[model samples]
Target: MFYDKVFFLGKILLHLSIIYFMIASNKIIYDRNNYSDKELISLYKKLVKPRLIEEKMLILLRQGKISKWFSGIGQEAIAVGVCNALSTDEYILPMHRNLGIFTSRNIPLHKLFAQWQGKKSGFTNGRDRSFHFGSQEFKIIGMISHLGPQLGVANGIALGNLLKNNNQVTTVFSGDGATSEGDFHEALNVAAVWNLPVLFCVENNGYGLSTPSSEQFKCKNIADKGVGYGMESYIIDGNNILEVHSKVLEIAQSVRVNPRPVLIEFKTFRMRGHEEASGNKYVPHNILELWALKDPIENYQNFLRKENILSEELEVLIKEEIVHEINEHLRIAFAEEEISSTTENEIAGVYKHIHFIEKKPNQNTTEARLVDAISNGLDKSLEVFDNLIVMGQDIAEYGGVFKVTEGFLKKYGKDRIRNTPICESSIIEAAYGLSINGFKSVVELQFSDFITSGFNPVINLLAKSFYRWNQPADIVLRMPCGAGVGAGPFHSQTNEAWFTKTPGLKVVYPAFPYDAKGLLATSIEDENPVLFFEHKALYRSIYQEIPEDYYTIPLGKAKLLNEGMDLTIIAYGLAVHWVLDEFKKHQFSADIIDLRTLQPLDVATIYKSVKKTGKVLIVQEDTLFGGIASDISALISENCFEYLDAPIKRIGSIETPIPFAKNLENLYLQNDMIIKEVNILLKY
Candidate 1:
């Protein structure tokens, strides 16, 4: 009985210690009331002018003079406060609702007006809508429409700045709703791990569209989320302009000097509907009124008046000046013309064929395997391009697991030949950064299956960089695809079809060493982004002797590997290899066409080939449904209908997950047996 009593006392003591520590750590150490009277009033005036401008823009949008407007009515303090805190050199990744922040950053008022009007004078040259404005010269990375995706990009930008030893900070603004996305969590984890110079600002405006914060999160406050990542975080009165500015500046300064990421939660409210046309029926009337009383602009104005910092004459003069400035810019924007035809032609010319110096053809006429062709092609490419950077996991010093980039690091120093961390997203983001900054970054993903991790950077950012912002991102993504190597489901995947659906990206799969060398050289010289899908099984596949000198194969052009009168076999990458092998074994002299690029598809070649042969066979290593084979067959059936002698045939992997066993894997991918299916068509 005495021992039990002692144990209970010990437990009580331990509990007391934990409670004491929590109380000590949770105490607020910084206060916002320490700012000078003039500074506080200046911050208040800055936030108020932007909020009024947003209101006027919304009015214009409602009047149909503007297309759309994302207002930051209730959350003005957060935007103004953060912008005031950041230096001119620091970068900002603002979301759609941060118009106040954009204005504060000195984005021209006429550019904003032109953006709303969808004019060529707009920030994005009329490519994107009003909310997505960005300027490289201004260091604004642009707004991302998809919720929470910019967090990872912000981290990536910070990483680049850090690598260059630049004392610049990156601030990413997101709403309460964005915290739920997987990207947000992933980015936060990565930022914490690396301690990047980033500021994650969460504008907790009570509701994420219709859902309240209470239903979406179980934590007491969003700032608590930062603690899990071992980051310093704070909850500030977001409606209080002075408080927001003081806290943000403090954190921004700390981040710039020490280079550590911090999470700042602004407990604010949305004064307007989510968008200009959005209705407030879902919002509770009482709650709206309750939050409206704490309007950032009005509250800050009242604070300034009470402190005797803002005079009535000065406030009126400031309002008049803002109105006149806005009107002048609007008039200028209206007078500006739409994007000129010459500008369009210039942008279109970016994708046009520029002549590449042609070299002598390969002297050796002996047929080689696919792998040997790719290896030889890469070996030659390294010597061709002076700006080419080969980077991937274990691709440099290790010479790659497949030895495709063997001796590359020895030939080129570490700067040109880089080995990246296993983080696929970082690898792709870094490549995009390097490419945009004038280096031709050739990024290699060990297997196509791992491309999922880098999909955001590749598909959303790199692929659309040209279309969205008129910025050329010349990057080559090399993925070793297909499933014939007995490497399980994790390592072997033919996932090019997923990327094919996305626009503004070029996809290529070369079948022979000569073709590989030519296509790779073309991709390097092109100003657009390209995904070079190299089949693992074909890495060592030798082909007829390729030229030793530098040369380029035309993009969106197909080559006829073999010519025959009866039927045509349409294939690319490993499928081309399979078809050639079948032809040799069966003595079938069928016409074979290799689709060098997928996005700018060589439809002209396919149409001509099918028109002549009458019978067509489409084959690929991907699954049957929604595969590249299916797409090719549909195109052939639709375009070359009158010329067909027999119905188009398509052979692909069965519609199931790729298995680990060699037999199952073989059964899954298109093989010699599948190629034999063409014999039935040949009989017709």
Candidate 2:
């Protein structure tokens, strides 16, 4: 009986000791001397909401109610503090684990729950999952899976804000692992060089998946790299909610006045695994215990309670209210429709506004080279649209490698015509950011072969964003491609087929000056990403009398260059010029069709010509295998096979890399190959 009494006394003492420690351990690390009592309580509530919601999400995941959960349980302080510090008009691009950003922005709880479950009422309308969707109304942009690319996107938004002189700043987030990506460095360099108003945040959460920071990067701190990029940077304790809030709040306001990029590295930890399913086996037990002792929510609650701003009863009441609200939102989201009403699976028009619209001014004419015609198209577009921006390397002063933008810098100010560093991927990302906003951007690649470096943003982001979120990307990529200029393989490539297969992109390859000017105008007016290919050889070699006024040609329409009944010759770019020259030289009785737009191929024209002639010959400047010629030939065979007298024939460059020698370059993708192929098709 005495031993049992001693044990009960010991238990009582242990409980009392924990209570005493909770009160005594609430140290004033970051004094909240400036904020009022009401404000302090409100900040504590903000810190509590996301932790509770994330815990509930994990519970749902365990019960198999939700497919996945990315826990931000421990890192709540940074998200809440940073979001509360920014102004409502400033834009934010958040990573996957930034639930507090959505909640602090006052996004409707029900809509966010629906988005996680992919319901019809979500921001993306059941298109994406979790925090993968953004709300423009809230001034938030969602990050794609590649976290580093969003930095460049933030650059674009900040650039737009600077040009408008709205005194607004932009903020973007990423983790320590993402700092190792090339886009991270490129974005900082671009932002610093342009002096854009942006705040870049990095949360060093000890580990990226299973890999620790030591293995990922050799730098002492992620913020240290900003010095090399010529930007101001800082390091802060992310666990201190008040400190995070006060520092960011001050920097955000000051950045609006100074208008430059700043990098802030928040030293924090992910108390949970990368995702709930991944488990925290990689982290040590002692380390976890150490971090748990520094929990942001618990510490903030302790601080508030010690300062007499929050009572125990009030804290419990706040949690109860938040839990009830979340439960109600979850209940409503569970009952909401998970798909669109118009279709069983939501595949809306992947790309809209594709039909060609022709615009012609008075018949005033002037002889101009293809390059001059392109310049005229851009000059006219810039004159008409005040929000248009042109960005590329050597474009501002040097006028581009092809001199296409020669006088643009002098005419338009530096903001309208800007030169970028040798960064294709990040600039493309910036262009995408501008495109989604109320601006149309034109990005030029010095050589078409360089498209490979920027392929991800085009294919994964720009090409699919419209279908995924109904956000149109109003941008144009000018590609200088083709052989016979002796630029070697790295510079010359007929790569239209690379983008022709993409759904949301439009491919425009014009053969002459008149077509180049008109087609460029049509492309500029379209609200989708357009891949405008210009053959380097045809830039100066081809001259024609084009209308000196602003005119646009039909996008998906084919031009019937010549008419006959013997054979149908279909071509584009340099191949069209080849067929035209061949017909003039040999006087062959053939129907010549110039496919001005390669994507929405003029099926009616091609079919009619093939049916009348009973023979067809397709040509391209790309290699013989897997070119647009193959798709055109297959389509002709499938639909117009019965009308054809012989199997369809094609002429293209041999399946070999473009050579540098003048003799070899002249023979490569030569026009002489078309005559031989046409003769065989006519005889058969």
Candidate 3:
């Protein structure tokens, strides 16, 4: 009981220290000689504007005008200092608390206010409020709620600049809490490996939401971890704007020329709560008072006054001017048209145009393995489009894990056939960076199941790219999927429904070498993010004569491999081949349909086949519940219900984890199960 009391007291003391120690130091002017007194005064006045605006936003929040408000109260110095050091063209991916960075970039206050008001003129056009907005023209990526992925995005932009030999750098900002994320380590590792020009700034506000740094990280300083990644690391007083600006500028200049990543940890405190929603309750009263005394804006204001740069009259005038400007912007924002999606016409159409560039192809066929055909398709794309690139682990010299990208390194060199660190999220986020910068990227996820590790980028960034902006991320994520051989649960899994269910993503799973080569060729050129799932079992197992010349099979079109009036067997990937073999064995007369792409599904072809056969059996290698088969079954029921002679039958892997044992694995994913289902459907 005594030990428990001591432990509880220790926990309380730890929390108290986190709040108090974060702002215990009063060091303000370190390297004040860099900025002139006049410039310092001007910077202080500019800083005051954001603080005042924040206060105004809080009032608006109370008035039910603004949906949310994330205050950067005491941490303004970090954003102002870092953004000041960056060039106009340099990219900045800021988190919610870095409002000063947006203000520093001179983004119109009216536009920002409109975004808060959910107006049509807003940055995200009312698609999102808060900080979920960015300016492509200004090179400022808006803060997504998740912070870690942006660092990888910054690394990608830096890589693009490096590839072009352009003397530009990218500065990405996150809080100390973000350092614990896998994406942070992944992004830093990639930046270090490539020697990309990226400045990663972490504002150590001592807490992640309500959790203190003592509990959040097991390190002394976030910057110290950068040393492990072979990056230049530094820690400084984040409250001192002059010190931050000078140090960041020095490193920024060196990085712009030499090209290397630098990690800077700014020791600061968040004076306010995490956001408006989180009331100031977690912090102890005494600690809040201590931090209030060390307020960044107030400290800087005192320094400016001491230097005789700011007078009483001037201070008053500046405050009045800033307040008036913000009020005007708010007034304009409130009067602007409110963005609404409730209208029938608007709700009916959300996705952009999707069409294949129709060009007649020569019927020249050449026998090739699926892997070789994919390589050929990539080679042709690289030859035709200079901006096209293939990136993944062991893709360069080792020629990928399955030898899919064999001879690519020798043919294209390191710049084109880029080798990456084993950072899955960064791999896809880097693809996003390249796509936004007018480059097409084909990323190979070593195995399909590994995509789970990088699901954030795939779902949030890649999938949302087209829907957010009409700009399609011209990226193809090549996932080597499916379980046939004994590569257990971690390595082998079919994940089609995961992507197909997602709205803005296109999923293509070709069954034949002909479709594999053609669909891949088109996916590279198409203006949409495509998840090209290459069946691991079929890469070397299947061989066919494919078109030697460049060709593209239309995406949303199914191929009829066999025709029969008795029943329809619809499948994709290796399932198509399995169903065909089973039919041959059983001597079953059935119409076989291979769905080349899962999303933007060829429902018309399925309806046609179901109508002709009067019976349908959907087969998939994915798990039974919530699989692609369920959707196909529903489509058949909805569209061709009258033509059905039997209730729709569907076969999929058993609803359980894929086992390492051969027997259990076979039982989990068996073609015999599908054959039995087909037999039942035929008899019905």
Q: Which run of 10 residues does model 1 get worst, by summed lDDT?
A: 23-32
Candidate of highest TM-score: 2
Q: Model 1, residue 240: displacement in angstroms?
A: 3.2
What lDDT tens digits, residue by residue, belong to model 1 across residues 1-684?
999999999998987676666445433232337778667656756776787677678778768887877667878777888888888777787877777677787878888788878787776666678677557766777655766567776776676676667787889888898888766776787788777888999999878887888987999899999989899899998877777777788887777789988998888778677775775677876567667767777666766677677789878987888888888998898898866557666456434334656555555554555555665666667676666778788988788888777878888877577776677776676566555434667888888889898888778777777777776777888888877778887888888898888767889988777788778777877767888888887676454666665667888888888898888888887887788878887777678988878878989888888888899888888888998888888888788899998888888888888898988887787575645677788888
Deviation in Å, model 3, residue 186 alpha carbon: 1.4
Task: Please state the error at residue 411 of candidate 1 in Å.
Answer: 8.4
Tell me the tens digit of each residue's lDDT in model 2 across 1-684.
999999999998997676557535634385896999988888888899988998898888899878888888778999999999999878999888889999999888988888888787887766667777667889898977877789998999899998889998899999988988988988999999999999999999999888999998898998889889889999978988999999999999999999999999998889898988899999987567667877888888888878888998999999999999999999899988657456524434577645665776788999999999998999999997899999999998999999999989999989999999999999998998887567889999999899898888898778877776777888999998988788898988989988988888889999999999988888888888999999999999999999999999878899999999899999999888878888888999998999999977899999999999999999888988888989989998899888989888888887788988888877776668888877888788
**Candidate 1: clashing residue pairs, number:** 13
RMSD of each: 8.5, 4.4, 4.6
User: After TM-score superposition, what is the CA distance of residue 476 in candidate 1 from its true location, in Å?
Assistant: 2.9
Q: lDDT per prediction?
A: 0.77, 0.88, 0.84
Question: Mind giving the per-residue lDDT tens digits that candidate 3 earns over 1-684?
Answer: 999999999999998787667555454664577677777876786688889899999898999988888889988888888888888888888888888888888889999898888887877667777877667777788657777888888887888888888899898888888888998999999999989899998999988988998887888889889989998899988988888888899999999889999999998888878887897799878767777777788888887778788888999999999999999988888888767766653432335566667544588888888887888888888887888889998999899999988898898889999988877898899888887667889999999898988999988887776556445678999999888888998878898888888878889998778788888888888868899999888889899998778877788889899999899999999899889888888888889999998877998888888899999888898888999999889888988899999998888898888888889889998678877887788777
